[model samples]
Target: MSQHGVGLRAVMRSAAFLTAGALAVPALAGCGSPDPAGKPLAGPDTAPAARDRIADGGTLRWAVDAVPETLNAFQADADAGTTRVAQAVLPSLYRMGERGRPEINPDYLESAKIVDTEPQQVVLYKLNQQAVWSDGREIGAADFAAQWRALSGRDSAYWTARNAGYERIERIERGASDLEVKVTFKRSYADWKSLFSPLYPKEVMGSPDAFNEGARRALKLTAGPFVLKKVDRADDEVRLARNPRWWGRPAKLSGIVLREVPREKRAAALTAGRVDVAEIDAATAGRLAPHEGTVEVRKSLEPAFTQLALNGAGGPLADERVRRAVARALDRRELARVVLEPLGLPAKPVGSHVALSGQAAYADGSGALGGQDTKEARALLADAGWEPGTVTEKEKKEKKDKDKGEKAAGPKKDDDGSEEADDGTYIVGEDDKARGDDEELAQDGKQHLKQGGAPGAYAPKGTAAPARSAPGPLAKDGKALSLRFVLPSGPGSKTLATVAERIRRMLDRVGIRTEVSKVEEEGYFKDHIASGEYDLALYSWPTSAFPATDARPIYAKPVPAADGSLNVEQNYTRVGTDQVDQLFEQAVGTLDEGESRALLRKADARIWAAAGSLPLYQRPQLVAARSGLANVGAFGFGTPVYEDMGFLKKEPGSPSGKASTSASASRS
Candidate 1:
């Protein structure tokens, strides 16, 4: 939800419901440059000799970057890892289809339909009679009611991560049968299917105590094809076994073991045959391309985009003109070109923050940021009362003295490492949302490691760096133009550091002094981003199938608690406007898909105009799987059907391959 917005930001709700699938063979070339349209072209040699025939009863040692903080997908800190596990072991009324569209899951629900649209929209869901929890509780209206109540935003104590569409519901009641759930919204919601996904049981969602404590140690029960068997934090692994209570087709593999292999070591794990499948990035994909005959690297555009979030509430970024100036100063295309081009990936500049390229509603609105205009950046700063000025050595010395004085006066941190002024709670945006202190769950939810750039200098081949019109640091009222840029620090952060440096250099040419800071990987989101402790930051938002429902929380107005701390939910940048929120409301309220899309585009234009964040490019999803793995690989805009995944019994071209393919193809 990037707020785990795959933080579950607005669609902290949508991004959390990501679409991924096993990759199809005919692997991409070793040099991963995306084609002209910013898409990757499959290489002739990369294709699987043929689909490896499926064989059952093998343990899949899948590589996950980290162990999930919480198994409960709805929790505030849940990330893609949580969702990956959740999809395999939990039951949702609907699951994402291959096309990134939602399809009703027949295993859980017999049917789900919009029964009424008039006086507040109504959705009726009928549960499958045979569908039951592993604990033997029948899936019914009570589970639906409890989930709705817990997420309705009526109870502050529930501690739910997002309440986008659920907050609009008037009530959830039993329909004609005990198994039927009737949900009526107070306001029309076009993407209601995004709700109750991986629905929780009554026992888990019933009360504040249950909601908070039930998911702490481990899941009590699960209704998916798999059930958690062990969570060995010491060993850094989570193991899942096929659910005995499953009423559907049995899972092909006997069990799944998610091993926490660091991104840097995943390739080694695969090469060593320690792991069966792993999520690979562009660089890693390229590195593994040599072993294409043995490993399949699948590449696709992810429903996410890396961005530069400018803090709008306080700090140097508070001024809209300054925010706009910062947006105009950077060369986003160059950044992409430098970072992704080397990977043989597309460097297409993203225009909309809400919609990625593959979505029907996507539109380029980057023009509002005015594409690398340093002259315009200077002019904007000038119009905002800025003037060129240089900081002298004496002034720097005095500033250091002042900083020392302030440090001496500041409150000391406790021996336990907690800040005296910290109060424990941190700010989370409707879009940027995390914490590492929560132990069983590290507070940091966003996974910055995997999506980080490969190690290299970010100097693109053809693009020239922007030139500065103003010579010295731009200033106004004696305040020098300076920004604190923060990014996660650890392995895989080389690209982010280089990108930040590139931005710093570009902004430097425009007379804006940028101080790049790196937070430890564990405290990156919690201490810096979610807490609003930086002037500017870099991160990505991975969207779910429901963009309209998810985009609002990322850009909606920040509502502060009475105590004055912001209840950021998912909007980490703390940027919003009446028009943006109004358009978001209109887009989600409309039932017409075309009209909804048009409204979203219009809303994106407004978002661009405000310039709190800039969409750089679509984040590439690359994964590497063993040659014999079947029904699993790079799933783009689709969730893998875990039940269908298995390892091949015989290598391709073997004598029995045809019969094995025929038998397993039918199962798929």
Candidate 2:
């Protein structure tokens, strides 16, 4: 099952409720300036300003969904959207480029040089005399040491796979102001520069476990271009003021205010001149198309890819044949056209586990599966001895509906009134066996059948019904098959559901079954996918500034957690092969990018052969800004360049300016 992250439906609903409530309630007599329409206002600007108010001091209200659970760099749990907000307040030593490459920035670090490279090792330097925190403490080697120990030691939740390469560290030597950190891998470790970034202050972090608590309270001690000035967790708002002590050039903007807004309201907020910028969903993108003079849409690439992960640990999905058949049943092209293309994006169908850009150096051949082909799908199922009636005709009907949008009921019942329940509770024309007998046998007397038929009565032996037989052969029912697809409920989830419905229709025409179940947000991650209790799921692989080559852990055999449960993030697919593992190891050890890409390609092919995940599409980070907002630069999933923004001021004779307030509005 391809797993997309949690949908934003709930968040959007909350936003709607808040907006509605705010509109329904009467306003106070005077809170702020009134609009030209003479209405009590929420903020200063009546119309969205073209150029930013050049004032030296004031707040710039920004918006985001949620705040981080921890401030510790090693333990931080933030989504890409949240990370983009944090980047403005926190500095990373190395910044990511458009092609997923990294480069050092002098603003944060005076200089970073590779002092040594030999014998399976490399050493680098952190200039100590150059930088300082807002509290006037010198930023130096101790901060680096503290950061490394904290990330590599315990409490490394924030230490992504990118940090795992640092485990080869041999020693750390400190100079008066500079820190010399040396790393020695058991074998040659590729992408060493990708390993370490800027280190956090040790004086503040103190210990690993205490880092989160300390950072939360010490929000004012950030070393970046901006400093946290106000944090209202209850209201889902945060404000960051310019850091006067920042080592870099002074920020152009005075401060940034981040408010958590729902995805649905983002487009309207931009159009109504309430918010300067926001991320708009694909469905809403169309509404903004006509307002080109007032809006600018930017399309960029992201490391994120949408995929369907198959839980092969148990159930009917245990068979690779079934998994591959399901992959063949999907119509990715249709999904891209009808579902994604409307949003002004393109979809690249891939069978490989690794993304197209990140393929290993050695990989050349295509992935294990190809694009949708119903005939081939039927052949695969036939070879696997799968029969049509067993899975349910709903799958076939759903698949057919994708292309034609025809609403067809599931399999028709015989005139004798022998039809199964839609819930899969009964199998028509089966032997007379009591319900729960197999369950009781499986549990070994843990559950007993009731004696009477009142509430929980078990049928007597003579009256017991036979176990319902599995659905009939697909060959008998036009080769129809039924497959279940699970996804999280949210605004983003609706897109996944549409895609699921499309796939269902396509497969139904090809003799396959597809059913989508939208699971609850909190329970979905823990009880569903992690426990191997799902059929298929849609998800994404969130890449970091330094993406590692540790794909094996996620696709290999399941790894049991410390509490004896399984780690869903790792290997839910239950696919393992010595060849693929070796390729992953080789790619990680290879220093050259070309070599690594080649190896990754090979590993991707092997993963495709295993049919672990069906690649659907890649997700892009989209932000919609009203016209007059300038200097908007997006750095992948990193941070938005707010300092660069300048409002577009309308000319005196312009129609818009005549009806709106003066161009010289002050910053709030």
Candidate 3:
């Protein structure tokens, strides 16, 4: 069998094991009351109040960043989190089964069948007989066709790599109540099923041209459990009402209200009972633990990944020795204990492009890249000719003169004879004069000459400033082994900053200089890393249900541009190899799950060995809620289904909703 085939088979075996495990485990039951030890809250035994005025009319407010640019499913740039909220109002043709498998729902589509499958070539989906839109319009194959065209159409700003799968399609055909949608592909693709499902409504989408212009503004028409009642863009709030026309089990809740709240304000809002549920940071989670009964904690697999990217364009880190040395200098265990463990859960270090739960590309490996190896680090640096404490006579003289001048001048005085400057600017003394002159000369072309003056004056022959010494024994060619760690400037950004500081201290112990900087969210992804203007950054990659396809963009090569900006591809490490690319292609193209996974493992090993990136740990999803809430279950992605939840109250009569007969009164 081909390598791709082998890898695909392996992935299937692993997936099978995971599926079995999920089935064997019973659903988690909650205690009757909250636990004082901050353990998970117990489930409520009693049902919520029945249609009472006190419980009937209130908006369950939630928060998020913004509305998705494209509600269309095929569009790549659609924020997954935002789309999930929209999905509550807009239903998909099918929903994921309990085991994370896709199943056709009769509410939207009575049945669906795969008419043809030739890997990536062409696949067809036949819709059900009775699928209809909320506006009382029939949904047919044309809807699916229009939705794909809308996503892949010329004007789509949300275009994604997934679009490439639909490039070969010729046309979609509609047949009476049954809709036949045909997809043609440019090449044979093994994971075609990941792209083919999920049909949208045609009547609401309208014609391709019309949808391209109006999809963003129109919000009322939908076939889901809820319909959009009001949208306040300026205030970042969206109100939803249960869809009376919904064809399935009606939503239990009256409506839902989504509000956008900043990360910092979520904890306070949860405490004040302004919101039913809120996402809390690690530190906030610790602070709220004392009130365990009122707050509930749910842990889920965050699709996000935190890691360090290497710059492999042949600068200071061009050699493997230096790269391995730097990796060895890091104490991964301390990072987890000090940085991640405090947040509530243990940190699992990753060693490659793929996550632990991922397919073969991410097989069992070391917890961290190389583990902690200080001896190996020093040896590598020594091999690179890094000297220990080698200071030239000139440097010694400069240090002595600088110290002497500082003592003689003492402290500076302000105009009011105060000790310090009001503006916080430093004053220079005679000993600092030469250093300032050198800095100015470096900025401009002008230089000082001893006797004769020239257009471009030269420094007096022997009096030239000494070249800056290399940072340590590992550095060569006078290049400083410096790294800049870029982090997000938000509440969650603090975690990254702390990690960066620890790393800085570790590297500094081995003579490496490191700096940390925070960038705004808007420009962070687009300008800092995407523009190729940064050396290194600590960022997260949100996961999708389909890890195989969703992770493709992050490892793709950095496409260069004339203006020096990198493309949207996430290969931040700038390390791309023909072998690795071939394996990735094979893994995606292979039909058998097991074989695909094996190939993925090989690819992961190569990437890890190359030091392209270092995976730190997986973050747990922490959520806070009040004690009165019941039936609240968490999903792997951290989203909670409020409809399945209820509340507890004291019963006025029977304990089990059963009343006793008044036999004595009847006898009298």
Q: Write the per-residue lDDT of candidate 2 for residues 1-668, one digit (tens) a residue.
A: 10000000111112233221122212212336331112111111122223344324434544455554544444434343335445676556666544444566566655555555566455555553546777887766566656556555444543432245555555555643343334445456665654444345676455644565666534556677787787667866666778888766566667776667765566566666555666554445555788676666655434455567887776556766666667676776555444334444554443345543432221212334555655666666666666665545774575467535423543324233422111101110011110000000011122222212332245565676654332333553354344567765532444555556566666666565555676765465556655666787765554333323445466554557899976545665665556667777887777666566556656666666556676665454455654544445223433344454444445557786422422322144
lDDT of each: 0.68, 0.50, 0.49
Per-residue lDDT tens digits of candidate 1, residues 250-299?
A: 88788888888866567677776778788765545655778775677765
TM-scores for candidates 1 onward, in order: 0.77, 0.71, 0.69
Best by lDDT: 1
| Best by the TM-score measure | 1
Each prediction's total of clashing residue pairs, residues at least 3 apart in sequence or on different chains, is 50, 78, 30
> What tens-digit string does per-residue lDDT give for candidate 3 at 1-668?
00010001111112233221222221111356331112111222222334331232334555454545555444334444345555676545544432233445556554444444554445555554444567867666666676666555444453332454444355556544256555565555555544434445664345644454444545546656777776667766667777777666556556666667654565566665555555544545555677575556554434344566666655656555556566767776656544344444555564445543332234434322356666656666666555455445875696588669756975444333533211100111111110000000010112112224433345566676654432442344655466666655532344555566667767766766664666764466556655555656665554333435545656665567889875646575676666667777887766565566556656655555455566665444455555544444234332333344434433467343211111110110
Native-to-model Cα distance after best TM-score fit, residue 540 in candidate 2, in Å: 2.4
- The deviation in Å at residue 475 for candidate 1 is 2.9
State the local distance difference test value for candidate 3: 0.49
Error of 2 at 517 (Å): 2.6
**Which should have the higher TM-score, number 1 or number 3?**
1
Better of 2 and 3 by lDDT: 2
